[model samples]
Target chain A: MTGHPHDHGHAHAPAAAEDGPPSEYARLGRAVREILVEKGILSAADVRRAIEAMDARGPHLGARMVARAWHDLAYKARLLADGTAAAAELGIEMGPTILKVVENTAAVHNLIVCTLCSCYPRMVLGIPPDWYKSRPYRSRAVHEPRSVLAEFGTVIPDDVEVRVHDSTADLRYLVLPRRPAGTEGWSEAALASLVTRDSMIGVSLARSAHEPVETA
Target chain B: MSDTPLRRHHDMGGLPAGRVERADHVLAAWEKEVDALLVLLSRQGIIRVDELRRGIEALPPDAYDRLGYYERWIHSITAALVEKGVLTQAEVADRVATIAAREEAER
Candidate 1:
């Protein structure tokens, strides 16, 4: 077997678990991780490299794709037709799940939520937002998506149909948010700046061309 | 009236709930490690992501509600490792106690 896939320097120091300083889950996690390491099930570098790779994936990747869709109609069709291949075309590995890109149109607004235990397109978005994983969001996103969207300052008019996609472990969704008006002729890079993580998740709309970019 | 469809606590969807609080924070280092370990172990074919999900899903509602996202993952990951015979529960327990003692002595 490989070096205890878990053995090597723990990336962090020990603490308490459950209630005190550290969490019980935390201690158990560490203990379990160390034992595996000692067994050569996992190495320290394996753990570290895994984490580094995850950290490398960010919502920006999704933003870039959304921006590309806005820049090229053919790419948009491809994204909608086959998200996995399109992502591969862009050199983005989508991990194990199949990505489904839902486009937001003038009359149809799409929202993405994993009602079950926070399934998300983590391959590109890295970790999901805390709110996205909360019981409130998970429970309410499908039943009251408009309200949830309103909570995020995104109001959907009565005329527009709001569609919420419930993601599973094997299938994930990404929102191809409608490009803001007046962004015509904008370069793909510039357009990408307006595609906020929330926009890609359908919590918010893409920023207006005149608006300053979101820091996140 | 139609009978209410029963669902697991974690299977909540379209269920009446409170308002969503929109907030976010960076993942702590340990949480990231838990995530990484799960990924690495899955890559090594020692465990499957769905197995981790099952472990999380099987959590009693109280414990499920109590643990954070990564906390839940680590709990499930640890349990799965023990079940797979890849790591013994005794060793894990002893290591946890050892860690608890070290943390206590440091304080």
Candidate 2:
């Protein structure tokens, strides 16, 4: 599913030396990784497998969870109660981190951020978008969530109370967006088609029934 | 930005910044490699996420500001490995130089 189109550019391109060599940091990282592999701390094949594992997961798993919650009240209650276990129910490996699902009701909206570091629920969302780690998003998400959301084309009404969750600690949050109107009697899979990564991050809402689902 | 009493380098919630830009989700080849290395290191119990976070936080403010996301990860991962005595700075430097020379020879 498509995420909110927040245009925070990559702040730093991979650094290059004056003579067009790789940046010190990049070279150092490669050197250390190679040394570790040689020392038998890790193997090249292990690195390859890890990359494959991470690449296998994406927002589709989260969409499935949200879709199930939309159709099943019992599942919704469980998801809100224990997001990690709920995600595990669908065979989503959350690793060692905890997943906390926050609900957006008509009266209150929730936004997620990690002021200290980008502590995201990567198991479901995969790697955080570059913008999510940008300085603007990290600072503004908690202070001016409304404006930030507005920048994403998600304008929350003035009457609604905005509750910003700063993920400073272990508990990572996923926003369970309020299911859109006109989605009644739809199958879970069909409803899941409306969920987007941005919506789960609480930066934007799910696509309305009228919007076409954009496949990644 | 300098670290303020209200906001540290890591404390970014509610600070005034700029607009979020839209970009492609493409990862550079080196980035993918580093990403894999990070997961592999963590999975092998060589470093914990908390330890990695601490390493990132320990970076100089200017470096933290200047580095990209995966750059920070690479920096922290390297630091963690060194701090844990898994790899020494001298060895890493030597290896980096060797790799650079090898690449130059190839070119």
Each candidate's TM vs. the true structure? Answer: 0.91, 0.88
Q: Highest TM-score: give the candidate number.
A: 1
The local lDDT score (0 to 100) that residue A187 gets in candidate 1 is 91
Give the Cα-based TM-score of candidate 2 against the true structure. Answer: 0.88
Model 1 DockQ (Cα-based): 0.60
The lDDT of each candidate is 0.84, 0.81
For candidate 2, write residues A1-216 as lDDT tens digits: 111111112122333232145667667666776788778887667766676677778888899999999999999999999999999999997887899999999998899888778888889988889888888888888778888898999999999999999888778899999999999999988999999999999999999988987644
Report DockQ per prediction, comma-separated.
0.60, 0.49
TM-score of chain B of each: 0.89, 0.87
Candidate 1, B1-107: lDDT as tens digits? 97997678899998888888877877666677788888888988988988999999999999999889999998888888878888777888899998777667767
Interface root-mean-square deviation for each candidate? Answer: 3.4, 5.2
lDDT (Cα, 0-100) at A216 in candidate 1: 35
